[model samples]
Target chain A: MSGAGEGPGHGLGGRPTTGARTRSIAEAAWAAAGRDGERNGHGRTRLQWLMARFGRGTVIGIPYIWLLLFFLLPFLIVLKISFAEFRIGLPPYTPLLEWIEGGYLQIKLAFGNFLFLLDDPLYVVAYLNSLKVALVSTLIALLIGYPMAYAIARASPTWRAVYLLLVILPFWTSFLIRVYAWIGILKNNGLINNALISLGLIDSPLPLLNTEVSLYIGIVYSYLPFMVLPLYATLEKMDIALIEAAADLGCRPFKAFLTVTLPLSMPGIVAGSMLVFIPAVGEFVIPDLLGGAGTLMIGKVLWSEFFNNRDWPVASAVAIAMLIFLVIPIVVFQYYQHKHAERAEES
Target chain B: MTDTLVQGTHSASSRPEGSRPGAVLRRAEARPIIEIQDVVKTFGDFVAVDQVSLTIREGELFALLGGSGCGKTTLLRMLAGFERPTAGRILIGGQDMTQVPPYDRPVNMMFQSYALFPHMSVEANVAFGLRQDSLPKAEIRDRVRQMLDLVQLGPFAKRKPHHLSGGQRQRVALARSLAKHPKVLLLDEPLAALDKKLREQTQLELVGIQERVGTTFVVVTHDQEEAMTMADRVAIMDSGRIIQVDTPHALYEYPNTRYVAEFFGTVNMFQGQLIEDEPDHILIRSDALANPVYVGHGISARGGATVWVALRPEKLAISRVQPDSPHNWDQGIVEDIVYLGGISTYHIRLDSGALARVTTQNLERMAEPDITWDDRVFVSWRHDNTVVVTG
Candidate 1:
């Protein structure tokens, strides 16, 4: 190809070609070609550089965009609605921002909803009641789940698989169905009352359903697997030799568990507790289905405000306040996760 | 004071009324710290340890050496009170400890994996056993410091097990097990995880620690070299049975069976029939040899009884010309030569197609080859070097 290009320049011009003249002409042609090649190479590299940048941008930007569109955008919309005034309309709330004449923006936000929640004792009681219920149910779930997780982790390989399957088997049925099943078992004419009355332990059917006790049972039963799964993962990966080492060092079996097994499974405990606690605080179905009028929970109040009262602004305000209240625990959970990841990396 | 009190009670309880005088004398001379009497451990249909019996002397470093399924670890676990014998008994320091739980037994074990608590610092790990006894805080601190110093890990006491090197973690495990001053210390392949250089150094360190503490240490190991280097006496185990127990030197030089001889090191065996048996000397005619081989000592075997002569590779010498020795010599052609830095091994093939290995030290540097491949050579050994076995 180079020879063919050179043939046109050297052979067509037939004036007595001297050595110096031929060399000068070849050098000019070479310089021109070098300039063209440089331009082409630069353009190619520039395109490649942009392509590489786009590749990295896609990897990182996609997740950020997903969070923004699906999570952050919805949260901002709720926040905006929380500030708007309530009105009888198709959307049931007025817009907080409006454009006036001369292209000037006017903003109107109502603080009355937040002020009304603070003034009303019912909202305050519901918040406190929800927190108390969540705390007690999480404790119950932890107590029942820890021993189950430890047993499954220490079981033989074949038995371990079976135990894990049993732990997760409740998920096969619909969650709402499981919650509804608890009502039948815990009601006055249900299994527990009937069995107790038939055994002559009770003179009549006691009021078991539509009570705080039923709420606690439903929450614990539904969230028990969440508590056990993370705990099992941590306990199963634990080295059994540590417990044996403790026993060999003169520790009794129970003390060995406290000193070695319990301390080492702290990460799992924290993870499992967060998983159960976060969801239990906002629990609505169990409270609505099993809780009586005495059990005033924020989730049921929020549901009533949105659907029964047709109060969108107050419901949005309630949701925003609940999120704000939960931020501290969520931050604490994130800090724990971060610390655990760092510890893992160091080891 | 507590040690003496415990020992007194143990002896008073275990000693029979008017015990044999010989038994009392033996106890006074060198008491058996741990006695494993006819212990048998069976898992379902498989017998892990079959009626194994051994007595480890006080302040002795004993090793159980065997291959993987030979029940060495199971025997050690029994000593540690981790496994209950299906039959027979285990006694520690003259006390019946067969029914005792591990936490109550006066024994500690250094696990093979080092089993250091990842969540605790080295000082805490060493102090765990001491704390279990509810000792005074001041005493626990002093004892933990002393153990850390003994292991040369004073600077690393504040570090967790994961932060320390493998050798350092191993020392922590050793110090933790030794901290409580238990009557017996069991080590299960303690140095198996360390590299070769670290393993050799740690083996010597282990021996030193055991001697200084005067604790009866029963180490279970599959590496023959490690067992021989670290133990005062080695017990070779095979197929859930104690095959032989002897000092390392005696076990190597005078192995009673072909299994013991081969397990300790490489040995070449010749199957033969005993043709002549005298009081001082014996003759065996082997098919691998052109003539009958002679030994200095005789065994009580009838004529024409099948026997085996086990010869170690290092004991045999190879030469190009036939030696002046009248017996214990064979003519063969060198097939392969492995030149190790310190020693050279020559594989020679006899006329009967039997292979024999002869190893010689490179005492002098050789610029030119003295023996190369495919050279006809004679391999000979002293009559005392050959061990005869009749099964």
Candidate 2:
């Protein structure tokens, strides 16, 4: 009541003071009603109101709980296996906990698997090779996808949708089938050599299959859509006036593209690179099918350790090491994303 | 260098009393910087700018004013070298520029969207054009600083365009476009994105900057008020053609056609027949008025010709008592009164069944209007206020 008397209408006249008094009286009645309701144990209405107010929380909880159950739970299980010793048993690994003598529980932990990974040179070489292959493949995809994305982005509106659909048209087929088709084209007497020979340009078949080049071709072809889609999205949304402004500033077309268009599409480039690099690092199918026996990647090493060598503990440890190797690039990607988000918020 | 045909020649009757006459006087003697010789642009079959010829003098703030789809923007684009004319040629600084690309042309354009590079900071955006010329690093830095200071955005030099306000971003765009000191600067609806109050302020600031720099500026705008406020000379465009070219005062006071009068501002129009045409004076007989309207000046038209009489709303005086004048006064009943704080506009319905708008300043601090709705009133104008147009 005192606060109401000291409000904006304090010095005016009788009419405003009387209006403020009536408002204060009404506010007091509302407070008394709330207290009365709480004391009478009428909690059902209050609970219903709380639920109505916080319904968005319930909607957000669905995906949160899903990630906990599906992703985090499986990861923890693998982590537990990575700590146990290997043995010929039902689960093919030693138990983390057991009941020893006198009905006392004993816990056993092993660091031998992690130690073995560091001791062996094959693991070191495999990790480096996987990094090299993923980096090379990501670069190849970017070089090929950027122009395609730019062309599609600059196309007419009706043609833009058509070109985008054509880029993703390869995805409707099975991944395994697509990889298999690459084998036929990259064989010794495959399409390239056959065409050259028929055109009288080649006298002998070329060794096109089972090489690093073939592996790169396969990886790039498989992940080209992932690279092109993000690039197109950013390029299409860019204002065409920025290019004009650059030209009006006395920049030639190519220089304008380098200074204006390229820098503006960097977010898409980073996003596409991350999307292709992370999966290509652990890619097993393309390396096994096209890389033949020479190419060594961590995914193949992990596969052989789990199946051929039957070292489940060592395989789990290798998986954990591979995850650690990926964390560095993911962190860099996160930093760029955070910077972009801040810039967006400021605007 | 010497184009006698493009020189500005006018009489006192054309240029009104209140506009910036000094700008007109200064621009009338300056040499023409840009000559657009019957340029035509067509997008497939639809013509955007059709055989439009214009001349912009050096150190003049010229505006191409028109409504949307009226070829004003297309003409500006052609001047900026972004759009090549389908016919004819353009000359900038006495050089043929029709074949020159936008990059090679000595002109810069400030886009309506302010299209500042989002990836660069304000300092870098202003330095971008200088860098393209491969100027010394120290010179580029100094010029960028100088441009920023000119726009009063020196404190925000390090900020990116996204972090700046709309007005700040607008200033940065202006600075970047002017950093190169191009022979001509083109602006496309520069203040359309700003709010009304800020727009008015920026308009004056832009004029001040133009005067300080003394660079030839060609601004394209659909807003008549902005053109009138900022431009030294304005060209009205419509349907891919130039309608009339004159100073703001001349364009308003002595419009050559009905379209120019209606497009520039609000006016009450009367369809009348020229009863008498003389060297000193003329008479118009309008069915919307009870008596024939007498004009103080004669026009180049025959007697008994169909003409339009355009009377501005502000020029008419409204009162309850009948005025002494019989020819220019009309009796009407006030149908509506729009109170606009400083002035009141009365919508009157005349006995001839025509609607007329009369605006008057509120001279007294009265609680209620003395001339309310449904009150019979007389609205009259001076003989010199009549603008007779044949088209």
Candidate 3:
């Protein structure tokens, strides 16, 4: 690995034309090597320095490329396939990247399915329902969960731990289990129905199951913890002095809460709602299990298009459409977070 | 004229004739705006405020000064109706306000953290209390504007807490607290968050504002300098009891306890016994030095009572040679010297292990450095300069 094995006169460090100059160059290189610390630099070479320059690429660049490949690439593929026409018994058809004689293909494409979606009312309704359901569920969850979060925040330290545990415990168990458990209370012959009938509250089972009410309950149940955690984080960090300060400023308890506590808790509410709403928009299972076959949702529609109708192109198109619906809000939320971080820095 | 008005309305035929409105009004006329009458607040077994009592004048800027956990904040909270006294009552404007909740109390508190509402506009935060009282919309707006203007925050009304600077946010909190027009304003470490220079300026401004508003102010602070500069009367607390309550100058000149003398500021304390009592002056023989110290006050207490005499650093004269003025003479070797600008402090180690710190103002550039580290020096204070502590 060394120029030493070869003549000292014949290497990159040497003046190749003359032996004495080469020897002098070798001696200088050796002195530089000797100046190194206890960790030996004797065997170091130009190749290691060159490799170190590109070393960070292996760490940061690989994950970046990998995410682009597995995550971004799949999304783009869905977008590409979405523009293709769907046919019965055919996988989603696309003209993207057809092989050429040079063993290469077309690299870029356009949005025909997006045009088809815009022209159709059902697709538009799906987008609207998703937005409607997600927003409604998030609002309901926040309204119910803030008090619980506040109670948790103000509770004794031991009780706070217990309450927070109860809030998050549902999340630790399988999401499916919680959804199914809701069905037991919601079904016609299930807990609520049976209890009501047995107690002579109703002669017949009410049409409570397989309704938007049931779907709403399921959505709220699934996302309530999301709202509570963020709200708790904000509420717990709140200075009790702030409440006292407000009260001292002539506010009654209710007014103090309205002015100080509620306003300060808005960031938590916004953050929590964003988290709950975004995922709930794409929710397939909860609505499916509780919504019955008549449920008209974007996720359900996409699921049916893929499995029931065997329209792969439309399924991919639905996935892309879902993404298009999501992108703006995500960007907005991330921008808010970044701004908050900056404000935190300034303060 | 005020006394006749009260007596005319009272029932003179009541059981004890003189104990009626006549006496009550007479007492009320001279009484302070606030009185903590044997107010004791105990949390479990820890007495946060132990039977403390003090009077605050109608427009006095009073300070409760102490170190952390010294019950200053607790006392302030009790006064503000945030904490209930365990065994005694607090009177505000001659009304017993012990059971009153913080929201209902006439007093308003500016919290230590400057707790401005994060979500509201600065104007909205200020308007909150007025709105709570169900004031008319126009009146609420007017008062909010007035408060903001008072705090010089009228232009920044729409700015949120995060958008404003620390000082601006602090002003918003100040505005909000003042908007209520409280009977008395309680400030808990009001300028603690500001930088040193800003704190000093704000302290002066706070005193001016309190005076202008004509509201009594009770400020709780751990910083001795803040308490001294801001308070008309300072109550020094230690271990949940008020050690001494007096004007800053009085407390410095006539400390009632060794703890109060040391806690208020830096002092060179000598453990001593009373040697003689005089009408104009008293002499105290100290174990730390060869001579006795003469203080301004006369002490008549007996021979064996352990006592202390305190000397402020600036009052003590330091010289490398023997003192030419003989009556107030003492000696020590300079253990350490710190050359602070405008004044240099000499920490002189005595025959006793205690180090007596003496500061001399660097008044002249022509004067040679009198004492340096390890230089044996004579330090003395005038008879009138020394303060006595008999605790």
Candidate 4:
């Protein structure tokens, strides 16, 4: 039993919370303090609570296990597959590198596949061609998409919703079918040529089919929405009174657009460019279906190595090289995303 | 300009406040700059501006006062040439600007939202107008620097608009609008974005800036206090019509109608039948009140003709005994008493169930108010304190 001094009237000594309940309240305070770093809380907490909750089964252990099972496991498999030996005469055999006899290791692990790829210049050409196409397509898409996005932003509310729906509807349709439709349109005797000839605008069918131009058309068609959506999102968020303010400040409409509207839309432009460029670089369906055998891209080479030559090890090396090459942009994009989060919080 | 009539004569559309002795003294010898004719704007079915005609004199700060849904903003937009009037004309320096677009108009506006270009630095926002005129790059830079220095934003010249405070942004917008040196500058609720304290300070600063710049500033605002505190002339609007255009003192002291009196400020009004019409005063018998009221303004009030008598809360005096008052007398029970620091207001419940609000000065605090809640007392005002109004 406690005395009257332990009651709430006597402050901490008198109150139940100050006395026995003090310890429980402290525990509750600690519990309430954090949620992110915590495992059970899971969504959000601080480092201390996370550390406190972390036992032998927690802290680094669970995360390590999850990371190993999901992320590192796939990479390990790819690494092993990449180094395993394969030959035309020998059954594709595999081995791990270890310093067994001499000071040097790697008895079966081969660097010959990468060496052959470097010596052959065709692989280099393919990589360069893929980069060129993706870059060109991204530029074209941005040029077309920005105005379209701006129009959507400036349109009335009903039209904005309708336009946005139309822009994204292409994504819902079969992507392969869209590419095939472009193929039909770009063919030598297809609808575009037929229409021009019928109108006598062109003397005859222009050579549009199976060229770099056709490949470009297909890529831009597929990725235009990707560019537009981000631009639209950014444009929509811009305040309209700012434009009026610029005009009030004596700026003409065009000048207001150049200084206020255009610069404000840069983040959207960059985001759209990244979205279009990343996928277009890896695209196989468009070039293969539209350009045929003339389009020598990394995807085609990768397919050839794995299928036509049955060179599994070489294909794996090419895959690993492509992944390494891609890491630069991915890391940049991730950094941008992190910064955007910080901006969101600050605003 | 020397060539334009704007610098010599006030436009014919403006209400003549020439007789007020202080109006001439307050103007400091500048003339009218902007002349707006019977300008009317109709958007489909809704009439946005209804034959609104007014002239803003050179170097004078004029305010268009109204609540939202009233046509003050539409009238301002017409002056800016952002909106085209369906009927009538706008003359800036005697040049017809009815169809001219906003960019080509000599008048510049400061938007209520500040509308600072988010992408541009403070200098760039101010430079935009100069650049449009195709000024040399060096000249543009020099002018931008001068404008920024005027607003005390020289240290923040390179900083983007989002970095500035609301008041700072307002100044930037103001500087930018003034940078072009238009014949007239228009403002649309310019200080609406700031907090009450900031808004008041900015209002005074804006009026001071108007004086220094010597450009006709025509502002549109919903706040009567904003209109009263900032503008040399206040135009009260209601339902797409200009009700009264006068100096702030004139508007409060002598209103033309019941609506004008009530809209421009708080008014205690009683709908009455005209009982007597003397040379300098009007007498009206109201159904809601027990006594007839004598208003100072002479009105053509015939017997049985309905009219209104308006007395501001501050104009009404409350006491235990009649204080030799002449306008009207009433016995009321003090219903609600609110102490508002600087002043206290009393809601006196009359026998007719109507409430008379009386604001007494807190000049002496030696004792509590002589009357308490539910205490029956006399409320009265002098003839000069009341005005005759017709809806």
Better of 2 and 3 by DockQ: 2
* TM-score, every prediction: 0.88, 0.88, 0.79, 0.84
lDDT of 3 by residue, B90-159 (tens): 9999999999888788888888887777667888888877877889999999998888767777789988
The residue-by-residue lDDT of candidate 3 on A121-168, one tens digit each, is 888898889899999999999999999999999999999999999998
Best by lDDT: 2
- Among these predicted structures, which one has the highest DockQ? 2
Error of 3 at B121 (Å): 4.6
List lDDT for all candidates, in order: 0.85, 0.87, 0.78, 0.79
For residues A275-339, write the lDDT of model 1, one tens digit per residue: 88888888899999998879898898999999999898889888888888778788998998898
Off by over 4 Å in 3: A1-63, A86-128, A156-158, A193-208, A331-347, B1-31, B119-172, B273-285, B292-300, B318-329, B369-375, B381-386
How well is each residue in B1-391 modelled by candidate 1, as lDDT tens digits? 1343234334433434213344434534678898899999999999999989998888777899999999999999888888899999999999999989889999999999988998899999999999999999999999999998878888998998889889999999999999999998999999999999988767777776775688889999999998877777789999899999877777888888889988998999999999899988999999998667899877988888999989999999888888776678998899999999788899999988999999988887755668899999989988888899886
Q: For candidate 1 chain B, which ten residues in a row score worst on lDDT?
A: B12-21
Any runs in candidate 1 off by more than 4 Å, and if so which? A1-65, B1-28, B324-326
> Model 2: per-residue lDDT, tens digit, B94-176?
89999899998899999999999999999999999999999999999999999998888888999989889888899999999
DockQ of each: 0.62, 0.65, 0.49, 0.41
Against the hidden true structure, what lDDT does model 3 obtain?
0.78
